[model samples]
Target chain A: DAGVTQSPTHLIKTRGQQVTLRCSPKSGHDTVSWYQQALGQGPQFIFQYYEEEERQRGNFPDRFSGHQFPNYSSELNVNALLLGDSALYLCASSFGLAGVVYTDTQYFGPGTRLTVL
Target chain B: AQRVTQPEKLLSVFKGAPVELKCNYSYSGSPELFWYVQYSRQRLQLLLRHISRESIKGFTADLNKGETSFHLKKPFAQEEDSAMYYCALSPSGTYKYIFGTGTRLKVLA
Candidate 1:
């Protein structure tokens, strides 16, 4: 079975430009979350989408936004990208509504490498 | 606010040596701790969770409430065990996870 999939394995953008990264969650999954991992650091949660609505968000600024489509696929958009925006954009998916299982594991994708110049 | 911390950015040990990766967390309420690992060229994946209290791939982690730590340990490290390990936390009844900076493990032959 296919796991979470992300589009445009890599992306390039410049300051003041906007970029959108796509993700297709694993089959039978309903929740999708986006994370940003800078070099030599762990991923920091960007936000989470469930039921076509954003459920929770991290400490990111308004420039970072996301949408969850009816098919459970999602997209992360970064506006006015800065050089620090260059990092690995990771997408993870889990199976449930407000999934609270202690064993709940988020399956991740290969991630899209975003480079901001 | 919930946060996770991995003090060591890099750790190297000889093959067959014991391995211990430190992780500490800060949360007021009950928290779910997890260890996630990413091997070379592989996507990040879950190694184990504190709730399971199960050993995976000969690795285990115990959540110490008093110390607010969930450290990953292995009795004997193998070359394949070398990877980037992250400690993540989710507050009780929440789905969002806060990950630590991560510890890169290298097992020398």
Candidate 2:
């Protein structure tokens, strides 16, 4: 079975430009989450989407946003991207509340490397 | 603020040696801890979660509430075990994960 997949394996943009990244979850998964991983660091959660609504969010700024589709696919949008935005964006999928009582264990994708000039 | 910390940036050991990757967390509420590993040219995958109490790839992690630490351990390290290991935490009933600065393990031959 295919695991989580992300589009635009690599992208480049200038500061102040907006960018969007896409992700398709694994088969049978219902929830999708976005994270940013700087070089030599672990991922930092941006937000989580379930039932096409944002359930939770991390400490990211307003420039970061996301959307989940009825099909469980997701899009992460960043506005006014800065130089520090150059990092790997990872998308993770899980079965949501149906699979686990607390929180579902997440499976990640290969990630899209975003570079802001 | 809740956070996860992995003190070591890189750890190297001979094959067959015992391996331990230290992780510590700070959270106000009950948290679910997890270990995620990323091998070369691969996506990050779950190694073990504290709730499962199951060993994967001969590795195990026991969550210590008092110490607020969950350390990954293995009796015999294999060369294939070398990878970037991240310690993550899920705050009470939440899906957002707080990940620590990862440790890169190198099991030398």
Candidate 3:
């Protein structure tokens, strides 16, 4: 089955520029979460979206926001990006509580690498 | 504050050697723990979860609530096992996962 999919695979933007990354939830999954992975570190939770509404968010600033669509696709937007924002953006999907999610397992897509100049 | 910690940044071992990657977590409530791995050019994937109590790819982890640690162990390392491993925790009453600083494993031939 086609797993979670994210695009574009790589992006480059200058400081203060805004960027949006997209992700398609795995087939039959509803919840989508975003994470930021810096060089040599594990992925850090950014936020999670369920039923088109943001359900939980991490310690990131207001500049980091996300949206989920009826189709279960998600978009991560970063405003006023800083050079430190350069990192791999990973998107994960999971079946909601009503579905048979395999206990807390999150399927991740090949992340999109964002490079801020 | 709840958190996960992996003390090792990198670990290298020869093939057929026993391997262990340590993970420790701090949480007020009972937590669910997991190990995820990412190979070169591959997407991150689940290796094993403490709740399963099942070994995956010859690897197993036991959750020690008393010690507050979950260490991944494999009897014999394989070159294919080389990858980045992360320890994650799910706080009680929430789905948000707290990940530790990952430990990269290099199974040398």
Candidate that would win on lDDT: 2
**Local accuracy of candidate 2 as per-residue lDDT tens digits, B55-94:** 9999999999999999999999999999999999988877
Each candidate's iRMS in angstroms? 2.0, 1.3, 2.4
lDDT of candidate 1 over A45-92, digit per residue (tens):
999888898888888999999999999999999999999999999999
User: Residue A2 error for model 1, in Å?
Assistant: 2.5
Q: Estimate the lDDT of model 3.
A: 0.93
Give me the displacement of residue A91 in model 1, in angstroms: 0.2
Please give, for residues A1-117, the per-residue lDDT of candidate 2 as tens digits.
Answer: 789999999999999999999999999999999999999889999998989988889999999999999999999999999999999999999987753545777989999999998
Q: Write the per-residue lDDT of candidate 1 for residues B1-109, one digit (tens) a residue.
A: 5789899999999999999999999999999899999999999999999988999999999999999999999999999999999999988876689999999999999
The better candidate by lDDT, 2 or 3, is 2
Evaluated at residue B63, the lDDT of candidate 1 is 91
- In model 2, pairs of residues that clash are none
